[model samples]
Target: MAPTIHCVRHAQGVHNLCTANHVIPDPLLTDLGHEQCAKLREVFPYHDKIDLVTASPLRRTIYTALESFEPVFQAHPEFKLIALPDLQETSDVPCDTGSEPQALQQEFAGKNVDLDMVHEGWNSKTGRYAPINSALRERARAARRWLKARPEKEIVMVTHGGFLHYFTEDWEDHSQYQGTGWSNTEFRSYTFSDEDHNADLEGHAVDGDNATLVETAESRQRRGKVGPTPDRAQQKTLYQLGTQSWNQQLSTEEQDSAKVPEGEEVNGVRV
Candidate 1:
């Protein structure tokens, strides 16, 4: 059977509590973020079905996975929980920086997660250059290949919001309502294909391409209203969750100018 991937974005990190544009390297979850993770544990419907749990090496993501899925881990020792450095967020921004693997093992302490598989400097950032965008795209594709190779029928990954966009490559502005990208602690399930993964590896640019996602029937049922555009209230909520706030020092005109066009997307995948 084809594997089903449950992609989850970490709950609000310490950086999220700030107004905007301020960067804090590899911060942990805020109190509210922890609360969100706890709520996720209560509401998540896939605990029994998930056979594998993977998390980005980032602190926030690791915490989210531990808080939300530790029960599943305890209940099913046969299920594996592995940390993947390649799954880190797709930005060179300070907030996206990750800690070393050894530090992460010490941080988790008695947790059941496996930190042995991580490579050295797996958390290092590529410099802020024009080509880094393409490199991140390829990294996303490579990570997809890695995940698909796993033998588990159902897998769960706790990662960052920015990278989840590239992971799905559904860069549509319409994707917000389509369950393409994610909100805090949100989980969306997708089915992967070797053919689609190969297309991305064989020179298809994630920026221009619409990578078709095969969402599970359960995923579709759980998704919000389906539409070309989100309603006004939904739009406000999305703007708050999906992008950085404009600098308060800037004039309204400057902020408007900085905003992407209403019908267009800013990040690869987001409204």
Candidate 2:
């Protein structure tokens, strides 16, 4: 049986404060971010059930996985959080890009986090890591395949907002203007679709099919609301916009800020 995956967006990072902070290379979580993780740790219900935890190699995500699931790590001394490069954000901006492995190792020396999968050039935006639509799609597929092959019965993946849409292949509420609808540290449970089970993992059969994550009914109930399903055109548009170059997207965001009223705010940040 496929693992029950819980997808979580990392808590508030410095870049989440405002567009200017996006220049802060691989910024850490803000104080509020840590506080959010603490709340998640308290509220998260599957602490004992999770067999493994994984996160994007970015510091904010690593910290989120460790802090939010600290109980799981503490209970199982044999497990270490696996940092997967494929789980990194879709954008190539400094804030989204990761740091060197050595620097991360130094910073998280004593932490129960593994960086073996985060190889050199993993942070580079070139090749498979590029923010192009094709690359992002392939990366998301590879991540799903990897998760399906894991032996764990349950898993947690702490990742970024923009990339979550791709990873789950769910764009029902995705907004090109606002990015993902997922709030910081918010998570939803999912399981591999039946199509995923039927497709041949070793061959290219899964490539043509939409072998993706299916949000559990319980997760939907937990969310308390479900928007209308997006049409194909809308999904395509959202995916294209979401996968655009981060700098280009940031420029668009800056241009849009001019339209905001003086006292109004965008993304909880005063514009």
Candidate 3:
């Protein structure tokens, strides 16, 4: 069976404070952020069952994973926090980009966090890590494939809110003009969909492999009663709108400076 994925958006960071803080390069978690992690640590029920813990290389995400899953690490010393470069935030803003591997290693020295998967140019907003729509889609696909191939039965991932939408391929509540609806430290559980259907919405297929993720019933129950679920047609429309929004944002950024606009209202909070 494929591993059950617990996707968590990083807790509040310094950049989440105000628009001005968005320029802080690789900002750390706020005091509330740490408290949120503590709360998650208390409520998270799979500490003993978790076989792997992964997170984006960004400071906030790394800290979130370490703090929120401290019990898991304590119980299983063999598992180190895997830093996945492909799980980095979708944007190239200063707050979203990660620090150099050396700096991260020095900061997290004794924390049992592994930076081996983070490449030299992982933080750069060029090439595969570009903020454009196509690059992000491909990265999301690769990340899904990697997770599906893992041997672990239960896994945890701490990543940004914007990228979470892409990773899950569910844009039900996504918005291009504003930030994501995912709350700070909020977590959703998912299981890989069956591979009977080989092609994705984009017609991408790999040896009849299906990388779609289906949210577990427990996760939905945690969210309480919500509105009616959108149909397949609605989902595809939302996905296309999300892709177009990303491309439009990329074009605007290319014409202007790499920095966000003065108001600093990004697609996702602090992204």
- Distance from true location, Cα of 226 in model 2, Å: 4.4
Number of the top candidate by TM-score? 3
TM-score of 3: 0.87
Off by over 4 Å in 2: 196-210, 226-271
lDDT of 2 at 233: 49
lDDT by residue (1-271, candidate 2, tens digit) is 9899999999888887776676789999998889989999999999999999999999999999999999999999889999999999877668888999999999999899999999999999779988766677778888988998899999999998878887887765665334666888989999887743333312234545455677888887788856434534456665555545233334324534534223323444222
lDDT digits (tens) for residues 1-271 of candidate 1: 5578898999877766542422577888888788889889999998988888999988889889989987788898765578887788765556667877788878877777788867676666643211144565666666776777778888898987667766665443424521234767888888863343224423444542233345556775687535333333444354344333323223334444554333332322223
Q: Please give the range of 10 consecutive residues that has the lowest summed lDDT in model 2.
A: 196-205
Candidate 3 colliding pairs:
none
What is the number of backbone collisions in each predicted candidate, taken in the order shown? 0, 0, 0
Off by over 4 Å in 1: 19-22, 78-80, 127-131, 173-181, 193-198, 201-213, 227-271
- Ranked by TM-score, the better of candidates 1 and 3 is 3
Instruction: Please give the lDDT score at residue 63 for candidate 3.
Output: 94
TM-score of every candidate: 0.73, 0.84, 0.87
Q: What RMSD value applies to candidate 2?
A: 4.7
lDDT of the structure predicted as candidate 2 = 0.79
